[model samples]
Target: MKKILLSSLLLLVCHIHYAQVISIIGSTSPAGNWSTDIDMATTDNITYTLTNVNLTTATDPGTTGLKFRQDHDWAVNWGSANFPMGTAVQNGANIMTQAGTYDITFNRSNGTYTFIPAAQPRVGIWGPAVDSQNGFGGPDVDMTTTDGILYTLSGFYFSSGSAYFRVNDNSTLTYGSVSFPTGTAVEQGPSIQVAGGEWFVTFNRSTGAYSFTYPSIGILGDATSVGWLNDDIDLITTDGFEYTLNDLVLTDGEVKFRKDNLWTTNWGSLGFPQATGIQDGPNIPVTAGTYDVVFQKSTGHYLFTNTLSNPEYSVANVKIHPNPSNAIWNLKHDTTIDAVTLFDASGKIIGNYAPNTTEFQLDGSNLSNGVYFIKINSGRDFSVQKIIRN
Candidate 1:
């Protein structure tokens, strides 16, 4: 009877030890040596937390930050190279942390941990367009965090207006830029004048690097007239939400619609003539024929009609303003441009440019120009525009 009673007592002690065994240890993690254990507090035993834990010293952020162990022993432990927040595993690498006082939370159930800095605040966007969707004077559209440095908000419909990021959602601390699509964030800066559309937005609180995705959808693939080039058959958007192309000639191949000619977001499907597409879907099939295509942006629905007869939409649309100018001339295209070369009527190369922009401003005051052929290169295709300077 005594033997069974002693065995039961041992089991109870083991259960108690297992239930109360989670602590941190490291260099400058409030501990100069690894021989000691600093315990954590837990109410449910599933989530362990340690508040106001200093993970580094004042002079330097030590290379090795901290790791979690159970019962002051390494028999069951969790560690990871990722810091601020990450899922740790048994026998993993050491967690490297930055210099700051943090309230740390570690999930005993999933091995996920988060180190939230005390000094850093939340970042969010505020504007009329955001207010329309998120509601006026409501909570700002909050950007989420992983490492707590770069914050992001995706697929947000920000109507063309002004927007900016404010610290803690209501603080006077602000980060803004001059324009949309791409720019660096500036404190106490002017409002960001958006191009007005739905886009993926990102902002880095540390470096102030931020960008909004451009809203341009184009057709690509071997089935396109341009064929496997980085170039796209630019579409026309009368409503800014749907794109269309008239007189497009395609051979028997496959195609897809990508945003801004980038594969970051794309649509494809099996059905032709009309169908709905999904992101990273299968390539869309095509037959040898001329087609008029229409695509819905918000939804992936598309339609193709081969009955229309109009100009072929296989070439880049370029406009040369003030072709006959004294000093300055402007060039623009529907798509991203690569290079521009100037050739005299005598078939001699007069000027060469590699300005990768939608618009190129040319100066012809130095040239005694009677007639010059300007070649604009987009992807593998090229367009020759005329310039007359008298």
Candidate 2:
């Protein structure tokens, strides 16, 4: 009896430690704008559009107020027919003040889609097909297979012209294996038809670039005839084979691609590498070592770091004080005490101090208005916090 009891207790402890609580709280005006607060296990997909945001608690899993514009015309001003329009910035909270209809979407471990809108739109936000209780922005696609399995894809397509695909029951949509004509751009559409058994889709043999319609699986022609080369480029596989731009490159090394105005790299099978470089347009050659690399176009900077080994330090905490500090600015920690080090986001350490000091007051009068990080080290434990010095 004691053995069974102890085993049960251990199981209970594990369950409690792994359990996550995600809650969304806020006030939305009937006009389609809102301010909200969210507290969750992780901010994996939490997004908001607003101008000002605030956090009221100091707990690791505390709550934050997200602000955004909820007016319907805001989207029009930005040339978007959508009701909400505005920019979103996430600090401890998110803020957006554009005067249009807008919806904030978030995803966490429990699956995706927790929409926060100022007011319900006429068409309403689409919910997930699997879990109707949760909502997602834009249309949702459901592909059923003969094995009684379902697949769904979300997000808008960013391409020139759109392409379409179909599937039938028992038949699965095999990406990469299917070939698309050169310059063919595929965009995800609102929906696609898959027969009950099995089916396949083919793109037109046209040589021009194509892209998908927003929220729909349907393809559309480019509004302007700017040609195909600049839209989608051809790719050469490591197997010494050439694949169309439509073929999804799946390999152990790095995969590079250009999106909008930026060049991006995904470490592929190399997992995380010590470094990665773009050999060609979208081809990334990773170092034999492993390290995750992230690139920012606006700043023209590449950030390389190790993947998460400890969940506690995976994401850095961020705090900002907009008001000018008369004396000093306080930097606080929410976890076990560790050595605190400050940097100017340029990877240069500005100051370092012992931990458990409750607060580290910095002489902000000499600092400029910009972003910085306060890195905390506890034994092998490491975490970073963002601080904006006004």
Candidate 3:
């Protein structure tokens, strides 16, 4: 009975010493030396939590490593030394973190960690004349990093050269590497090489991983002939990625650009957005008119220029009559007429009359019974009228 009681007491003491206690050690200054223990909760047997931890600092952009451990012991820690954010934790690995205030929770039983960032990450891209393709002097193009650790710059084009990921918009503080796989570490290195073409680029500063891929781009919306069809009218490729569509008629509606004619990959904007690199933004409104549209695939910028309107038809000034005239018709006008030309429905000139007078006669004895277009020139402007014959 005494031996059994002693064994039971030892088991109870072991459970109390090994359960409900956790802490973290990392690359941030607040994490203190890995040697010291930042004790967490003792009440929960399966989970541990920490709050209001600030990971932002000057060195924060490069990397922020973290790992949850039992008490102050490294042998019982969890993480993959270079693991990216949102990944499941692994024993003996280091968790990669971004610069932001966050509430971090770890599940000891499942080897998974949850990070709730308090703020967004700052991201942008820059390079020399060869890589940016915007001459040597430039303000770098910005990027979106909503997932905190992954930064993406879409519709990017560059020549065969190199560039770096700018840190906090500061050119001096930047990171770079070669063509790398997703989820690799982003260390301080030389510029990355690129080919000339349009691309969607993604970079993870925490893991130094980067990648790029080609994209299909075109315009779509209600203003076009296809009327909001995802793959209606496509822009003509000027270069490998830049596009232009000449003489397009648009109605009073909205428009957007999509990849391969799908809503899954699309872009739009508020107002008559132009000249700047846009994102997956809002819809752009337009009116009924003919235009020439230009889209820069490398930058996601678009421009629409209205074409010249058709010449007006002065029905009040000119008159052509004789009721299906099989003989001849009189063309009368009040203005000083310079010339009059008759054209068939196919736009082929049937006859040219230099009737430099206000009144002229149109002979239809040798013409077919059909519709024709009569053009009149006066002063610096021109007008058109439709004439019928029997």
Best by lDDT: 1
Model 2, 169-231: lDDT tens digits are 111221211123222323333322221111121223122132221121110112112222223
lDDT of each: 0.76, 0.33, 0.64
Evaluation by TM-score, superior candidate among 2 and 3: 3
Candidate 2 Cα errors over 4 Å, as ranges:
1-252, 255-327, 336-359, 368-386
Candidate 3 off by > 4 Å: 1-117, 129-137, 180-185, 216-257, 260-390
RMSD of each: 15.6, 29.9, 19.2
lDDT rank order: 1, 3, 2
Per-residue CA lDDT of model 1 for 126-200, tens digit only, reads: 876587555435567887654457777765667666778888876478888886668898898888877655666
- Provide the lDDT at 345 for model 2: 42
In model 1, the runs with Cα more than 4 Å from the true position are 1-120, 132-139, 215-275, 278-390
User: Which lDDT tens digits does candidate 3 get at residues 1-390?
Assistant: 999999999989998876756787767525544455566564567777777666533233234466678767766777654423444454654565655667777778886777676565566666662334463356667777644677776655566566677777676667776653222425467666666555667777677677766555667777777776334587776233446788888888988877655566676777562433356777788778888776654345566666675433332477777746776889877766788877775445777888888888888888888766666665443445567778
Candidates ranked by TM-score, best first? Answer: 1, 3, 2
Give me the displacement of residue 130 in model 3, in angstroms: 7.3
